[model samples]
Target: FGKSANKFLQKCGVKNEPPAVKIAELLVKSSREVWESVGRDTENYKFILQKLADDFNNIEENPDLITRMKAEPILLGVSEGKKYDLDSVENIYINDDVVYLEIYNELSMIPKGYSKFLYECLGCKSLSESIKEKVEVSGNTQETKESQDLQKKLDERAYLFYCDYPKNFIRRNEGWLKKLKVKGIDKIEAKYFMKAKNNYKIRPVTACILEDQEKCIFNFYITLKPDYLDISKCLVMYIYKSRKSREINYLAMMLKAPLEDLKYSNNDANQENSQCGVDKTEYDPQIDQNSTNYDSQLEDLFKSLRTMFEDCDHDYIYHCLKQQEEDKLINVENHLMEGNYPKIKIPVNPYDPPVTIKVGKTFMNVIQISQPSLGSYLNENQTIYCKNIKDYSLKFEKFLDGIEFHIPKDIDKSEIFSRHQNSLNHFAKIIKDLIEVFDCAPKFIRIFYDKSNLMAFNQDRALFFNFKIYLDLYKIEPTIDAMTYWYMVICHELAHKFVNDHNSEHEVSIS
Candidate 1:
C-alpha cells in the first residue's frame, strides 16, 4: 500500500516530499466546550495536537487519507438553517475559505485560505465555533452546555493551532523570500487565482501560488520558517490533477514523513508526545489526555480491531471469498419496489376531448401532444406529452438555459422537456431554489439511464457530477412522499461532493 501510495503521488505530479525539521513545542491557549465555568489556560500545541492526531492512528496504513477524510462523528456548529460538521467544512481545506473560531466574543482571525488547511489537515475542524452563538442563536443550551467546557478549551487551543504556524508564510523583506526558479519552471504558476493570505505574524503579504502546477487549485499549506529562506516545517501541499477530469480538481497535502523516516531525529524534541499526564489525570492543564479512561478506551479499540479482522467475526476477507450463490442482500422485485408509481393515468377519452388541468389553482388547456396517446400524447415518461416544455410553466422551464454551463447536445432533453413536463418543471424550480439558497450554480444537468437496477446515482440514488444532478425514472410518481424523498436524496448526494462518507458532517449539511 505504501509503495502504491508513492506511485499514485507520482502520477499526480508530486515530487521530492521528504521529512523535515520539527519544533520542541509551541504554547497555545486552549478552550473546552462544557457547562462548568472553569477557567482554562494555554497548553503546548504539540501535546494537544498529537492527541488529536492520535485519532488518525490508522492513517499511516490508509492509502487514501489524502483524498477522503475518515470521519469520527466529529461535531460542527449549529445554525438556524443547517448544522455544521466535518463534511461541510471541506471548503476550508479544498477551497480557499475561512471558518473562524469565535472565542469569548473575541473573533479569532481564521483567514480563508488557512481555515481549511488547519481543518482536515490538522484534524481540528471538529472544534466548536463558539459557546454563546449556539445558546443565543439556536436557543439550545443543553447541547452547548454539554460541550461548553470542552468547546471553550478546544476553541482557544484551536485558534492557536491554526494561527500559530499556519500556511503560506510569505513575508518578503530584503529579498528574503527566494523564487527557487529554474529553466522553464515556476513554483506559483496558474491560469486562475483565489485570494490567499500569509499566516506570518509581521510583514505578512499576499503570497502568489506557493507551489504552482500545470492547472489551478487552491490546496496549499505552503509552510515556511520564520526567517523565510526557503525552509519548510510541516507537509507542503501540492496540486494534483484529478484522474477523472485530468484537471486540477483535487488537492493533496503531505500527511507525514515517509515510513523509512519514522524515527524522528534526536533534535526533533516536540515530535514525540510527552507522557506527562496522558491517562493519569483528567483535565490536567499540563497533560494532553482529557479523560481518565483513555487507556481502557484504547484497549477496547484494539480489542475491537482484533475481533473484527483477526477473529473473523466480520467479513474482512470479503474480496477473497468466492460467492457462487445468488445475492441474499435484497430482492428488488418485492422488497425494493414502491407503489403509486404511475403518476399519470391514461384518460378514458380516446378523442382527447377538451383536456383541462389545474396548475396552482388555475386551470389551463392541454395545448398539443407530441404523438397522440389516447389522442393526447405522453412525454418521455410515456405518461403525458406536450408540444413545448415552455407550455407547462415558464417559471420551471427557465432553468434549462439559466444554468451556468451549456447543455451538451448529447444530453437527452426528452425527460426534462417531455409530456410529464409539469413534474420536471417543478424539479427545475427546486434546483433554482437550491442555487439561490446555496449561492452557487450547477455547471450543467443531463439525464441518463441504467436498465440493470432500480437506483443509478453515485450511491445508486441519483446521478451527481461536477455541479449537475439528474435521475432516470422507471416511472414518474408525483406523490408528495416520492417527491420529498427525491429532494432529500438530491441534497444528500450533493453534500457527498465535499465529504464522501455519511457522518455527522453529512447530516449537518443536509439540515
Candidate 2:
C-alpha cells in the first residue's frame, strides 16, 4: 500500500519534496538535547514545548496578547521544583547550524533549518510575524494599503505551520526559539513590555481626516521605541496636536461653516468645503466682484493703499518717493496708479510772475513782481487765448500771487464774487474738532485749488502728499477765501502729522 501510494504521488507530479518525517524527528531530538544540556528536567521540558505550541495555536486563532500571561512560563521555570531548570540549561551550546537537546535519557541533534521551524511552532514565529507586520505598516495610507496586501501573503505563510505540518510532527528547536527573546518579552518585565506596542494609544479618529473649506485635518498617532520616547512620540504628539487644532480653527473660519459641518473623511469634507465657498460666492455678487478685483494685476498695490490711514503704521512718503526715483514706473508708481492718483501736476498760480517766497521766523513777504499784462478785464474780447497748459498755469499762479500779497483788510474780501467767512468758520471749527479728537499735528499745512474744504499735510519732505491731496479732491470746493475763514484747516493737517509721527516713532521703537 505504501509503494502504491508513493507511485501515485509521483504520478500526480510531486516535485522538490523533502523528507518531512525525518525533519520532524531531527527537530524533536535537537530540542531535547539542547534543553537537557542545561540540565532541564524531562517532564518540565516536555510541558514547556506543549505550552509553546498551545500559545502559537491561540495566536493563530485570535492574535490578541492583552490578556495573555507573559509571566506564566517564567514563574514556572523559577519555582522550587523548576529552580535547576534554567540554571541547568544556562550553558547549553547552540551554534549557528545546530541545536543540542536531551530527550528520552539521551542527547540528540537537529539541523538549523529544522530548529528554525521548531522556533516558529513555539510561538516566537507568531510574535516575530506580528512585530514584522507592525514594522511593515508605514502608517501612510498609500504604503499601508500595499502592506495590507502583503499581510495576506504573510497569512498564507502562517498557514504552513498551523495546517500543513503533519499531525504528529511537532518541531522543537530550542536554539532558534531561545534566540527570540526581545528584552521585555523574554525577561517578562511588564512595564517595559506593556509599552512594546502602542495599539491602545490609537484613537478611533486617528484613522480619519476631518476637513472644512479652509483646511484638512487628521488625527496623528505615534508609536516609538523606548529610545525615542522624548523626541519622537511625546514631543511630536504635543506639537502635532496643537498645529492640527489651529488648522481646523482656521479652516472653519475660512469656510464660514461650522466644525460640525466637516465630514470625518477628508475627501468628503474637501468636496463639501469647495461647494460651501461656491455657495458663498453665489449668495453675494459683491463678494465675487471683490474677489475678482483682488486677483487683478494691481492687487498688491491696491491693498497697501486701501488700508485705512490709521492702519498705515510708518509715514513712508520719502520711502515711496525714493522708490519712484529708482525705477520710474516700478514699485511706488505702480502703487500710485493702483491708488487712482496717477498724475501729480504740481500746482502753479495762473497769473503771477514767478516769485520765490522764503519762509522765515515771523511774517514773510509774498513779493509779486508782475501781474497779467493783458489787464484784469477784457471788455470786448469774448474769446481769450489760453494758449497752452503752461501759460494757463502761469496766469492762474499770478492770480493766486495777487491774492496772497494783499492783506486781509485791504482786499475786497466779501465782494470778490464770493460768499463771506460764515461757512468757512463752521468748516474751520469742524477741522479743529477732528484734530483734537485724533490728536495729530502736521508740519506744513495747505489748502489746494482755492478749496479750504480739503486739507493737505506734509508728513515727509516728499512729493507723495499729492496722493493725500487727490484723496480729498472731491470733498473740497473751489472758493477764493476758502483758506481765509478756515484757519483750523491748518490744525487738521497738523493733527494728521501728529498721529502719523506717533505711529512712526512707535514702530521704530518696537523694531
Candidate 3:
C-alpha cells in the first residue's frame, strides 16, 4: 500500500512531502487495519478506536488535502513523548493488509517524503464551497452580521496557519489536550481565563475562548497604558475551525476596541499631568506674591489722575471755550499776551512743550510753549495751542482704505468698519470708567489716529491707533465681542506704560 501510495503521489506530482503527513497517513492506515482485525466493535476500545476512526475519516474525506500537500507539505516530529526521525525511514509498503514502514536508525540525516495518495484521499470543503456557504447566510441581525464578518476573517487566518505552521499547531494542540488530561484527540470546548488579581493602577489582561457549532474563537483582552487622560481597551480574537474530515480548516484574528473611551481617557490623563514640567502650584505662588504690589501701584496712579481731572474743572473749561468761540477769539497768542486769563500749570514732558491752562475774558486755551533752546526759553514764550476742547478728546475713526484691507472678503466693508469703531468706542468707555472710578490718568495723555501701525506708544504721553489691525482682528474672530479684544489691547498697552521694561518676561502677568 505504501509503495502504491508513493507511486500514485509521484504520478500526481506531490513530491517532497513533510514527515507529519507521512506519519499521519501511516497512523490512519494502521488504525484502520487494527480496527478491522478487532471486528470493528467500538464499545470495547471507545477512546482509541474513535480517535483512529476520526483520523481515518478525515484523511479519506478532505478534498483539499492533496492540493495542500502539493503546495506546502507539513513537517512533523516536535512532539514531547516520542522521537521519530523521518530521515531514517527507508522503505514503506503494505504486506498482507498490514503496512510496513522501514526506517534506518543509523542514517545521519532524516529523510523527507510522504504518501500523496493518502493526502489526496483526505477530503475537506473546497474554498469556493466555503465562500458560497458564507455568502448564503442572510436575514441576520446587525450584531449577527458583524459576528459573521468576524468569523469570515477568522476562517481566512486559520487556513493560512494550517498551511504554514502545521507542526506548531500539533504541538499547541498536544499541550492544550494534556492540560485537560484527555487521552485522545478531539475538539476542545471554549473557555475563559482572566487574571487572578485586578489592579486599577495597571492595565488588565484577560483571555477567553468561545465555541460555536462550527468554530472556536479565542479572545485576549488588554488595556493600553494611557498617554493622557483617556484609557483604551483592546480585544484581539483568534478564530479556529476544525472539520470532521480535516483537523483544521481555518484560523484568523481580528481586533476590536472602544475608540471614544480611549480618546477621552487620554485627554483626561494629559490634563491631570503637569504641562512641560511646570506645576500649577508654582504658577499660583508667583501670581499671589506679586498681585498686591501691582494692585497698590495701579490704585495710586488712578487716584492722582482723577484728582488732576477734577482740578481742571471740565464744566467751567467747556463754558469758557464756548464763550471764546462766540467771541471769535481765534488768536491764542494775542489772548495770552493780554494776560486777562488765569494761568494754570499743566504737567507734560518738558522736552516737547510746557503746557499751560489759560482762562481768558471769554475763552480758555490750553497752550504749549515751544522753545528752540534753553537760551530761547529765557528770552521768550511762543505759543502753540488748542483753542477747542473737543480737539483734545480721544477719537477712533476709519484710517485705512477699505480696498486695501485684508479682512474676509465676504464681510461688508462698512460692517467691518462699524465693528472696528464700535470696539474702539467700547474700549474708550472702559478707559473713561477706569479713570473716573479709580481717579487716575497718565500725566500727559494724548490719542491719535494713524495708518502706520495698530498702536504706537511714546511712554504714556502719546498713543496712535490704526484702523486696519482692529478690522482684521474683528474679521478673523467674528464671534468674539469687539469690546473684549479692545479692552485687552488697551489694558496691555497701558500696563506697558507702568512697567516700561521691554525685556520683562512677566509683562503680561503684571498687566
Best lDDT among the predictions, by candidate number = 3
Task: Give each model's whole-structure lDDT.
Answer: 0.26, 0.26, 0.28
Q: TM-scores of all models? A: 0.17, 0.15, 0.17
Worst ten in a row by lDDT for model 1: 242-251
Residues forming the 10-long window of minimal summed lDDT in candidate 2? 96-105
Model 2, clash count?
27
lDDT tens per residue, model 2, 152-183: 32232222212211112223222222222111
Model 2, position 182: C-alpha lDDT score:
17
Winning model by TM-score: 1
Rank the models by TM-score, top first: 1, 3, 2
- Give the runs in model 1 whose Cα sits over 4 Å from its true position: 1-401, 404-420, 442-483, 503-511
Model 3: per-residue Cα lDDT over 337-382, one tens digit each: 3333332223221123233443231101111222111100001132
What residue runs in model 3 are displaced by over 4 Å at the alpha carbon?
Answer: 1-427, 430-447, 459-464, 476-481, 498-501, 505-511
Task: Please give the range of 10 consecutive residues that has the lowest summed lDDT in model 3.
Answer: 93-102
lDDT of 3 at 221: 16
